[model samples]
Target: MNFYDFKFVFYLAISWCNLLEVDGITVAEQLKDVLMEGYDSSIRPVNNERDILIINISMNTMSVLTLDPAEETINFSSEFILQWKDEFLFWNKSDYNITWLKLKESFLWTPDTTVSTSIDTNYLIDASERYVSVKHDGTVRQSIYAVFTNLCDMNVDKFPYDQQTCMIKMGPWSYTTQEVTCIVGRDIAPNDTDFGDFHGNSEWDFEGIVSSVGETEDPDVNFTFSEVHFALTVKRRPQFYVWVLLIPTYIITVVCIFGLFTPTANHGLREERVNLGITTLLSSAVILQIVANAMPKTSELPLLGNFILAEIFVVAIGVLFAVLVLTLHQRAHTREWRPPAWMLWILRMTGSSKFLSRNITKIRHKSSTAERIHYTGEGAYLFKNLDESLQSVREYIQEEDRDYFRELTYVKFFDRLDFLLLFIFQVGNALVTLFLVKQ
Candidate 1:
């Protein structure tokens, strides 16, 4: 074989292989080539440059990952359905021998739809391995699984009882309103029966959705962009906070209140009543910090925060009352020190005398009603002088005996004051709670 004969033989073999049909030459095989003939993916598939191409957008929620209160964002998985008429992608069914075609996403012109309010500020997470559906009538339908974190202007004013409305703000990134119009959410989750397909978040309840189509004016470019907003409202399930924060804090506050005032004396000695108040106050403060840490560092405080503050206030006030109690008990050691008239009256009126310690009750004033009131008052100075003068004549009225009487009188006074303050603390706590919860 000469050199020219060898070249002709190689060319003949290549030409024969091209005609041997590596793939079947059916209409399905040739449809893509004919559709792409002189096709431009960058150009909008419209008859006129100024004609508005209408895109219908809708979504079905697959699952919600979370509604992050601190980040002010929602993470969810969704299936977005987009449909539009592509004037350039159509063909005659008689010639193609097929009513529809599934072409690679790369083979067709698609809208550059972006999430305007997304934290990432990126286009939707379209299916990387998706096919664009084309009917003989030029209708294009595309669906993709999109998972994203969208910015939601969360108003947690009511906190656990709050419902937040967040939107998926979608729009053509480069197309003006004159070139495109979007219709959104009008037919969302059409097959969703009783939300059977929706996998909900454990911390939130998925409320219904609303949608609107509007134009967004960009002053910098002096043009209006078409926008579609699908707003979804979610309500918080407050049971978690109620259990972890509210119930525990309330129980702790009540326990601290009782620990502060309820007389549990050991052998006539005051126990660690002051320590109880201060310690519980610090614990409540720590709990408050926990609640704060769980939330974003916002200036406005939540209702739960206010409720914890009120608990701390009550505990602090209890501490103050505890200090007052110790002061009264200390001052009683002075022979001239006497409990005030109101303190004496409280003990008699509220029947809080029964709450006195076993040792205090044993030595408490006991006699006729008239003499009981008079003696419990710690008497005038002349009376003390009379008792001292009588001490010399009656050795039975010893100095230690007089001291015991004075100690008993003031200890009873301090106990009565504690009871009164406990009542005040409960009332104040209730009022503060009502106000915070109502807001």
Candidate 2:
């Protein structure tokens, strides 16, 4: 009875012990599984380092989500809870602030070391959640550029949506910055309400900035970070050339056109006045040439350039008119009297020098006046044909003296009116050209 009872009790106890051991093993395995999962959620293996929390954020299609150095890049596999900062704390600055942006997105972080991840250019920024920071002495700059077929056709409305998201192209995927600033402005941020005067140069269609900041020269500050945005727009036509070249050319042409008013009937006239007009016209032409040289050659003429050429032509025609007027005055004066007054003023204005004075004196007195003076010999002459001759001579002398007074008055009037008309024409031409050119 003792041996049998002892064996049965031992077997029962051993079986009970085995069952308890199995239950204990199962509990231990379950605890180990739970601990593994907890380790994964709380600790991240990064760059051979362990135990790091992760942060995740979502942004808009063209939004920037800058990460703090302490948090680094986001881990794609981690679960994140929604987080937000007090909007008033950031937006309550004395200067204008954009508070509405705070309500749209959230950012998540957990003191996690960052993992490297590839970002696709086609990927839109998730605007629903984003991370932000306000570090002591922190500064951020953003620049945007719109790439268009031509800058000349571009308008203010066609500019990029966000300066922070817009980028200027440099290389295949690079860009250079046109501006840098901590605060957002029309030139820096799309959200800026104030637009500075922007002149578009069609040649500079592609614009952008560096994505990362260069190292600061100061030794105290060891790290530098920067982010840039870029954009592109298509254009319809070229406009830069017209504003830069044509406008100035047109103005100069108007000045050249004023040379036409110099009258040809003046005894005071000289060749130099005409020459001066020619020189100015030539100079304007040279300027036109320079403008042409700067631009790409095309069959179409610039509107301003055409106007300049027309002005030069007009000057040439005026020169011809002056020559013809002088010829007419000379022929008419031979049969009649003095040239017109306007012609005289022009001659005086154009040829006040010795050369013109000498030439005019020589031409005007070359024939009848000088010959008559030479023959007259400063003495009155009497002719006789007996009684009739004597009586007729006295009557003839009296009538000649009387007619001389009337001829003088008529000649003077003609000279004055001609002079006035010539002057008015010259001045009028100048003013009209100026007005047209300005327009």
Which is the leading candidate under TM-score? 1
**TM-scores for the candidates:** 0.79, 0.33
* Model 1 TM: 0.79
Give per-residue CA lDDT, model 1, range 1-439, as digits (tens).
9999999999997876566435766566677788899999889999888789999987755567788888889887777778999999777897656888988887788998877887652236444567888998899998766677898877876776888888888878998888988987553343356543564589977775677887889898799999888887778889999899888888898888877777544213444877888889889989889878767778887779878988898888888877767666665563345545475675673343333322322222233455322323456666756755564455444444655665565556666666777778777777777787677
RMSD to true structure for each model, in Å = 11.0, 21.0
lDDT of each: 0.74, 0.35
Off-target runs (Cα >4 Å) in candidate 1 are 1-23, 94-97, 121-128, 187-196, 266-271, 349-393, 396-399
